[model samples]
Each structure stands twice: as structure tokens, then as C-alpha cells.
Target chain A: MDVIQIVVIGLIATVLIVVVKTQRPELALLLSVAAGIILFLLVLGKIGSIIDIVRDLADRAGIGSIYLGTILKIIGIAYIAEFGAQICRDAGEGAVATKIEFASKILIMVLAVPIVVAVLDALLKLVP
Target chain B: MEAIRSLVQNLIVIIILAMLLEMFLPAGEMRKYVKMVMGLLIIVAVVQAVGELVRWDYRDEIPPLTEKNNEAELSGIMAAASRITGNQEQKALEQYKSGLSKQVRALVHLHKETPVLEVDVKVQSGRNEPDYGQLKEIILFVAGETSSGKESEGAVKEGVEPVTVQIGSTIETDEHIENRDSPAGAAEADLISMVANFYNLSTEQVKIIYR
Candidate 1:
């Protein structure tokens, strides 16, 4: 039922964007961004539940919170960067989209610094 | 066996998490970068779990590298570790000294002629010393008169005499002369030599104080 509602809203938004794009391109872009945000918000509630499940599983498996935290941060950064980049691409700003993605990649690597150091430290301890 | 079971369980959970997280990833170039980080996290988890199985403690997880200056933090950790080591060494030395003193007291008590009131033993505890933990000195505090017999007759006379050191290089020249002149000096010397021989120490290392 929720999917039906989402599909209907998406279709209506697409129709409105198609009808308005020729007359007012800026308005159409705004409508598309608005629709994307609405759809993301609708799905966001479900994402929280999925995250809770992952957290429980990680706890049971004896994984450290730090690793899980880093992974979660990377995922969030990727999702947000991808969302922004896609919007930029839709607006015909390919260069801006590329810059957004490059920034996200750097942020993800920065977040991963601890895990990388942990791996190296563990290996070093095992060696001697 | 329990560790193996838990390791398998952990791997399963990690794989499931990776799959679920992968589904959340965008179908774009950013996916690769995110996946790389997830892969490293899984690697660390697996390595740490294996370390636990081998009885090697991976308790000290590495802290965030970018949080502070690495050299300063490393030096701080080194200093703390050395301080803990020093405290433990000092405690062990104290216990060793007490235990050695008790053993010496018990040994001297075997000879009823000398009733030992107290025993003090010192050991070379310096790490740099070649004779570390070797008996450095043993001081026995004995009653003024022999506890075996003729105690009533000799106690008053022995009590009137001043404290005397039967052996040891640290003894004053006058005390050494007085110790030699004492009536029971030969018997005390024999007892002191017996103690030195038992501890593998030189005669001078074992000192007896008549109190």
C-alpha cells in the first residue's frame, strides 16, 4: 500500500515536471529536487529500522562499535554524496557532480583511517 | 572449540552486514570507495577474532589516528607502561626480601643455642648488577644469652654488656674487638659461619647482633 502511494506520487511528480519543463525549466528542476527529497524522506523511516537490525547483529558478533561506526559514517557519506551528485547531474552540472563525488571519496577514506591503522597494527604484532 | 564457533558466528554476521550495507549503497562510482572501507573493517574484525582464539589479547584497540599527535601519545603510553613495570618490580622485591628473611629465621631457629628475635636479609635487586637477586647481607638479632641452659646465670651478665656485632665488615673496630673478647665469641662465630655457608655468602656478609 505504501509502495502504491509512493508510485502514484512519483508518477504525478514526473507528469508535472514533464508538463512544466518546457515552459519553466527552473521550476521543473525544483520540482524534481523536491520530489527526490520527498521520496527520500518517505524511505528514511524504514532505514532506521534496518540500521537497528545491523547494529544488533554487529553486537552479537562481538564486533567493536568503532568499526561499525566508521562503516555507518562511510555509508551515510556515500548516500548523501550520491544523492547530491545525481541532482547536480540532472541539472546538467557534470563538473559539480564530479567534485561532490571526489569530496565524498576523500571523506570516506578519512573515516576509514582508524580501521586501516588497526589492520596494520594487528599484522605488525603478529609478525614478531 | 567455543572460540571457533564464535568466530564462525562472527563471520556470518559480518557477511550479512556487508550484504545489507551493500544494498544501501548507491549504484555509482562512490560504491567502490565505500566497499573498500567496509572490506577493511571486516578484515580487522576477522583478525581480532582470530587473535582472541590464539589466546593473544587484542584488548587495546587502536584509537583514532587523526585525533592527536602520534609521537606525544606514544611517549605518554611508554612512560605509563614503565611506571607500572617499576611498581610491580618493587612489590616483587619486597616480597622476596620478606620471604628470604623468614627462611633465614627458620634456619637459625634450628640451632637452639641462638634464639633469633629477628632476621633481616637484603638482595641485590639492580637489573644491571651481575649478582642480581643474590643475597647481599643477612643480619640476625639474637637474644643476649643462649636459650638452652644457664640462662638465669648468664642473662644478667649478658644484659649488662653492650650490643655486639659478631661478624660483618661494617662493624666498628672497637665492637669487633669486644665481640672477639666475649666469652661465647667462638660459638657465635661458628654459628655465623654456618649461616654464611648455608646461604653461599661470605662470613662477613652474615652479621649477628646480640641484644
Candidate 2:
């Protein structure tokens, strides 16, 4: 998006948030959520470029597509977790945010298990 | 037909999304969430409709400024200028040349350097006529004065007959042209400058028509 378009959207979001805060607190939270999602959509093209670079790097390093995909999945999990956590915090739910972060870390570990196992196997084979 | 189909599809998708969100939300909050989603959907629909209307209108309204058209509009302004200044054809020509320079300067002040494609002037002869030219002149004077760091004192000369000018933009059909509407304040000012020069009046006296 051009800077003007982004600024316009931001201004509209700010206005909606302000209006909602005064008249309806719950609606304000919803407006903020919508704004965040819209902003995310605007930057999605850049995110895709980042993912493409990471995929190319993994391929050149001979890490295999499966390994790269796992890493990407972990990254996606982290991002979604953080996003949800922030939304919860904005809604005044600190406990929900902490739980979200905890769950994300555990999920990341779970996704990394296969890569860790493969590395261990390679090392054992070299010893033999 | 295809656009209508796509629009129907979008509406359906929005309705489904709203319903899903309503299901997830608490019973008390569902109504508010649903209403907000509906409002957003309505905004999207209105924006889409307006965009389509503009696209259709622009397709018909935007026309290329041919050399013949350009000459005709220029000569018309020249005729009007000559009549107002009580100058002969040759004197009008001299006035046009000097005015062209002023016009170029005004454009440059607006940070524009493109060749002018065409110029058209419309004058209100009767007192009952709306002073569109005056309004246009004021807009241009304000824009030029602000951008060029020049005072309005000499921008428009007095005793010059007031005439309205409509500057039709050059139509770009080439892929590289990247055509867009004139900048925030420059177009109005440029038109005024052109009319002022054509009629031997100051920029302040020349009016621009914008709509």
C-alpha cells in the first residue's frame, strides 16, 4: 500500500477506536482486531517474500524441504501466538496472553523434534 | 455479468464469515459483533459500487487532446483575450507569448514541467451568471502563492477582463505514462495563470473552473 493509503486506513481505525471507546468498549476491541487484521493483510506480500528467501536458503544448504517446512511452520506458530497474545492483552486478558505464549513455545518444540532426531541420526552414522 | 457473479460470491463469503464469528462470540456479544461485521461489509460494498461507477464514467469522459482540439481551444481563448484587451490579432499574439511565459512559471512553481496539451476559457457575460471564473482564479492564486513563495500582490493585475479557463489534461494511452489527476493545488493555479496570460490580466483576476 502507498503511504497515503496506509495513513488513511490508520486514521479511520483511530477514529473508530476512539468512537467505540466512548460509546462501546467491546466494539472498540473488535475495531482494533479488524484494524490489526487489515494491517496484516497489507504487509502479507512482504511476509511472502521473506518466506520465499528462507525456503531458497534452506534448499541451498541441503537441509531438505521437509526440514524447511517444519521450521516455517514453527515460525508461523510463533507469529500467530504472538498476535493472539497481543490481542488478548489489548482486551485486558494478561493471563490469556501468558498461556498463549506458553502454548506456542511448546508447539515449536514439538515441531523441532523431527529435525533434532535427524541430526542425531546423522551424527551416530558418522561415528559408525 | 462476471462482476456481478463475483460480487454475489463476495457477499456470500462475508455472510458466512459473519455467521461463523457470531457462533464463536459469546451470546451477549454476538449481536454487537454481527452488527460491526455487517457495517464493514456494507462499507466494502459501497466502495466497490462507487469504484465501478467512477471507472465507467472515466472511460467515457477522458479524451485525448488532439492538435486540432488544442488549436481550437487556444484560438478561442485568444479571441476572448483580444476582445477583452481591445488588441488586434498581432497584439493578442504578443500577449499570448508573454502570458505563456507566466504560465510556465506558475506551472514550475507547482513543481510541474509537462508540456501543456490544451487550454479552454469560459467567460460569464451577465451579472446573473455565477462567478465560477472568480472562484477558479482565487483557487489558483492561493495555490500558486503558497507553492512559489510569491506574494499575491502582482499575481493578478487589475482592470483585466475576467475570463474562465478550463485546462483539459493530456490523455495518456501509453503504459509508461502513469496518468493521475493533477496535484492537490497545482492544476487550479495553472489554469488561472493560463487565462490571466491569455487575457492580459493578472493571475489573480483569471479564474479556473474545477469540478
Candidate 3:
């Protein structure tokens, strides 16, 4: 979305949250969560294009695609987990947000497993 | 240029996004975290765009800055030059003033053929004095002249008191002839030259008063 539209929507959501929060805290929290998710989805398309561009450039440079893919996935996990954690925290579910962060850390390491194995395999072959 | 243009565009978008988050986010710990994360992401995006530019060898597409480099160096050199000149001017003024006093005492002692008893020098309404170049000219004028006779040596043998004068003020009667006020002529010209030269000034620039 364009900047102006995002700003308008954010302002409207902020006012709505403020008005409902005292009377209905849960509803206010849900509305904020919805707004956050919508903003993330709006930027996701642009991010996808940027990723494609990076991938193409990396391919042209003759770099292995696996490492690049792993890094991109890690970054994607970081962003999504952070997003979810923010939504959870805003909902006053701080414990839930903490657990989400812990899960994302494990998920990122899992995604890096192939790169780690590949490096180890290469190092083993280099041994005289 | 395209890389830079897109970087600026993305940064603008990130800034708008930040403003939105800051406004809509609840005022608490989570809001702080979101702002921090958003700021970092914006920084990452800017760096990524710059990295793209570097990879494309975009720097070569731009012209060199030899002239601008020289300009900056010249400006730095000029600043140092001005500082040196300022210190030089202060030293010149001080040296000139000191030399002027010494020359006046020496000339007076030579003129009277006796050492001065006592002298007092004062600066009255004085500053922005002549510089070393003018002092050089004055010292040259006096250097070429003789103390004018063998009598000065004889008088020195007589145990005359030393001569003195306030470089810019009055001296005791015995030390100076107060002879500077003598009219412009052969005898007075020497003293007039003394006064003029002491000031590193011209005869016209020197004002003589007899007391």
C-alpha cells in the first residue's frame, strides 16, 4: 500500500483502539492485531520481488543457491516470528510471545541444518 | 542512480511505516520493541540497496572528484596559512616594539655623549604598531649612520650614567635631549631620523614634542 493510505488506516485504527480499549480491551487488542497483519501482508509482495531480484543476481554471480536460500529463509522466519510476537504482546499475552520467540529460534537453526551439514562434509573431504 | 533512487524510496516507505507503528501501537514495552525492530529493518534495507550499487560497479559510472579533492585540500591549507599569519603578526608587533625601545636608548646615549641617569617609557594611546618589515627599514636607516664622533667613547670612559626613555612615553631629563622637538635641519635631522626610525615611521609620521 502507498504511504498515505497506510498512514490513514493506522490513524483510524489507533483512534478506534483507544476508544474501545477502556470498555472492551479484548476487542481493541484484536483490532490492533488485525491492523498489524494487514500491514505486513501489504509489504509482503514487495519483499517477494526483492527476494527474486537477489536470487537472480546471486545466480548470475555463480554463487551456490542453497546458502542463499537458507539465509533468506532465516530472515523470513525472523520477520514473521517478530510480527507474531508483537501481535501476541499487544494482546497482553507476553508469555505466549516469549514461547513464539523460542520456537522461531529453533526453527531458524533447523533451516540452517543443511548448510551446516554441507560445510562439514566439505571439510571432511579436504582432510589429507 | 536507480539503486540510489530506490533506496531513498524504500527509506521513505520505512519511515512512514515507522510512524504508523508508533502511532497505532499501544504505549508500553511492546511498542518500544516494534519501533526498534522497524528502525533496524529500515537500516538493513538502506544497506542492501547500497550493496546492490557496489555490486553493479555503479561508482565507476560516476565521474572522479579530483577537482573537489583539491578544493577541500586547498581549504584546509588556507586555514593553516591564516593561523600562521595571525601568530606572525603578533610576534612582529612585539619584536618591533622591543627593538624600537632599544634603538631609542642607544641613539640617546650616543647623542649626549654620556650614559643616561634614568628614563621612563610609557605607551599612550598606542596600538596597531608598524610590522617587522617597517622595523627593518627603520633599523637600516640608523645602522648606516655613525654615532658621529670619537667623543662618545671618551664620555663612556668618564663613567656616564646609562641612557633610558619610555619607548612610547617620557624619559628623565638627563637621559634624553628631549632633542626630538628640534626643527628639521642638519643637526635635528639626525634626531628626527632617530624618532622616525624608532617608530619605524617616516619623519611625517613622527610627532616630536619638547618638554
Compare the candidates by DockQ and give the number of the best one. Answer: 1
Greater TM-score among 2 and 3 belongs to: 3
Writing each residue's lDDT as its tens digit, candidate 1 over B114-211 gives 67788889899897799888889898877765433222111223235445555755654223243433445655666687788998988778877656
User: Model 3, range B1-211, lDDT digits (tens) per residue?
Assistant: 7766765665565455445434543343344444444344344444554456564553466544565997899999999998998788767666656666575666656654223332223332123554323432222122211243222110111234445645667655332333333232244456546656655666644322221
TM-score of every prediction relative to native? 0.55, 0.35, 0.37
Residue-level error in angstroms, candidate 2, position B90: 99
Candidate 2, A88: how far from true, in Å?
Answer: 0.7
lDDT of 3 at A87: 77
Q: Highest TM-score among the candidates is held by which one?
A: 1
| TM-score of chain A in every predicted structure | 0.94, 0.84, 0.84
Better of 1 and 3 by DockQ: 1
**Residue B141, model 1, lDDT:** 77
Query: In candidate 2, which residue pairs clash?
Result: B136-B208, B137-B207, B137-B208, B140-B189, B156-B202, B156-B203, B156-B204, B157-B202
- Give me the runs in candidate 2 sitting further than 4 Å from their true place: A1-4, B1-211
Where's the lowest-lDDT run of ten residues in candidate 3 chain B?
B149-158
TM-score for chain B of each model, two decimals:
0.54, 0.23, 0.30
lDDT of 2 by residue, A1-128 (tens): 46677789889998989988988889999998898788879878876776676555434333357765665565566667777887798889999998987887677667766765665555443331
Q: How big is the positional error of residue B9 in model 3, measured in Å on the Cα after superposition?
A: 28
